[model samples]
Target chain A: MRSPTEAAAGADDLAAMFGRHARELLRYCTRRVGPQLAEDVVAETFLVAHERRHRFDPSRGELLPWLYGIATRLLRRHVREEVRALKQVPHVPDAGYDDAAAHRVDAQRDVARLSAVLAKLPRRQRDVLMLYAVAELEYAEIAAALEIPLGSVQSSLHRARAKVKAAMSEEDNR
Target chain B: MSRTDPDLIAVRELPPGLAEPSDEAVARVWHKIAARPAPRRSSRRLWVPITAAAAVLALVGAGIFFLRPRTVSQPAFTTDRETVTRVIGDLRDRAVTAEPVSVGPGQVIYQTIHVV
Candidate 1:
């Protein structure tokens, strides 16, 4: 797997760079905007990363966070679609099921419930939350990736988690 | 009994229905990547910003040079710092040794009051 630094040095190395980060970035994008538009988002992200490769400094941070930041900016353009997609409740009718199948449905219901709650969060909070939850970035990484203060990351994550927890309990009650 | 935080629970429990990037997309990016210059060092036109900034600094420096008030430098009273120090020392001795006249025989002062 090529580091972004290597990719930045030469365009040919981008394939190597993409080979490294693309899978995770794709999953992140997919979770945000669903599968259909995820590739478009990732394509636009790498292209932008290529153009702005000059700005990346390995000493300051890693390329993954920088790529996330770039991918996120592109995702912002599709905020409406993302919100709509995330809010979609998979139309799985509840039927008498084996224990494992019932557990799967419950999990899917939780995911759907979380999605609706996530859409209602403030844009800034939602970005912080989704990046943390979906991308699996640490607080420090998320801070660097978002160019926000570590304190802000903590606060935003706190708020986001609280909202998700509250929404989950509400769903459980229903 | 539940020690897990909501976020951790969400991560472990909520599986992502993630979409993989299409092979066509990968190939498209691959071709785009191939079309790029394969040089090891990323090319940055360093001279452009550096030269522009240097020019701006030069212009500002020149502007200050032309616009600021000029000081009139005077010829030194002594040729060197040693000469100036010697002169000051001599003047101090002469000042301290000279006695003031007692107008009424009441006191004799070692230094003159008016000159220094």
Candidate 2:
């Protein structure tokens, strides 16, 4: 059992950690699972991190990747929901004859198409791709986040990018 | 890292709405985290169930050990004074009427008796 002082200190640490990384973590989760489920994922991520804090080896990598790793694991439980959400990315209707509206429509179509492609990707490849493109983590950070080898990360990302490129080109040719 | 890659551009252009989570959403998450119970001492939590399980197992084992049926080695037939007397009388009668038997080098006699 933790003493009162210890509990208070742990709470303070959690608060500090939340303040430091919650926003970005939330954004990353939102991209993967939409805002509706992202909040829960974020909360659960922190709770898991707090519970497993003792197991975290500081020598391995930065705390952000660890948080991401935790979030990614939690996200696995909601993969079906995520894929459904991605496949259902709403298409914005053409509302006007202006260039801005035209651009918005084109962008929306691209997002919808890309989301469909993402939904169809294999889970590991999608994870690697999202960690690279959405979370914007480097190869080393991605490897740490997924607990995969650096070579696996590179290969998975390469395959993901190739697939995405092929898909986008197919969409263009259509 | 190529800026001209259409795939990268499309991925980067997902939507502005997903760029940041609302402040209220963040607060709700913070509130949930703050409201969660403190992490239980794992050893303390685990010891209780483990001890309980061991005790139940011990009790079950004791019940089986004490309640199970037992086997005893006994004679095939019941023995009584009357039966023993009758057997002895018959053996004496047979000896009186029997012819004398010759003894051999490797031959031996075996006998069984029931005692009460």
Candidate 3:
């Protein structure tokens, strides 16, 4: 506790960072991969974040983006696993929702199709789109996270969305 | 969903109940790491009023670090770059592909991230 270096990384800073964003990052990891691998991915993310906590420039952006960048890097290690799980489209977590119609929404078919389209997107586009739609990250946050220019973030999101739309439309017609 | 872009609709339909890591999982992760290493000089600050302002934006009990500042600088954080970089370098090596994912969208973006 008395280490001169450790003082820079107060437990409050690490705890503050983790307490603030762990749940959201976990859920994002779960959706990207699945529950089985999600914990590993999330755990690795925090471990990396903790080690790199010093490199984190709060002035560069909020911590979530940096966390996402780390999480995304970890996810890349298991991209094959992620693709496999997405192909399965596990049952929606909220089984108790009131709407019978929600149950009938054909999530399996749609997610499977989306997964395939996502597989084909340029890695940047996919990253941007996933951060935008899935993580609900703002453009600036994504720019910081992905470390691309703000313009690139917007363009990648646009391209990614267009490609996804095209692919989904193809599925609908089929 | 049908009325929206099919892609948007499909993703939007995703239920929010994704499973999260348990506290036990978090503890195990924490146990893996030893003490925080030495600190290198970093270009960040924690102006008190900014921290308090960032806290006010909290939803529930959660608060985030607000990168934007309305005040002058505080102390530069001493970061442990050597150790951290090695750890991430290991991660990059362990990665399935040998590409730098932290910076992508090509060389321009990669250089920009490093330069900034």
Best by TM-score: 2
Residues A1-174, candidate 3, lDDT per residue (tens digit)? 134344334423766666667777876777777765766777667767776776776556666778898888788888787666655555445334567755555455566667767777777887787787778788898888988899999888788888878877776785
- What TM-score does model 2 achieve against the real structure? 0.67
Top candidate (DockQ) = 2
Q: Clashing residue pairs in candidate 2, if any?
A: none
lDDT of 3 by residue, B46-92 (tens): 46767777777674335334444467668664478997798889987
Better of 1 and 3 by TM-score: 1
lDDT of 2 by residue, A1-174 (tens): 445444334434888879888998998898888887888899999988888877666656677777898999899999999898887778668656998897778767767777888889899998988888877788898999899999999999899898888878876785
Chain A TM-score, candidate 2? 0.83
Candidate DockQ values, in order, are 0.12, 0.43, 0.14
In candidate 1, what are the lDDT values of residues A99-148, reduced to their tens digit? Answer: 88887887777788877788888877888887877777778878888889
For model 1, state the Cα shift of residue B3 in Å: 13
- What TM-score would every model get versus the actual structure? 0.60, 0.67, 0.55
Ordered from best to worst lDDT, the candidate numbers read: 2, 1, 3
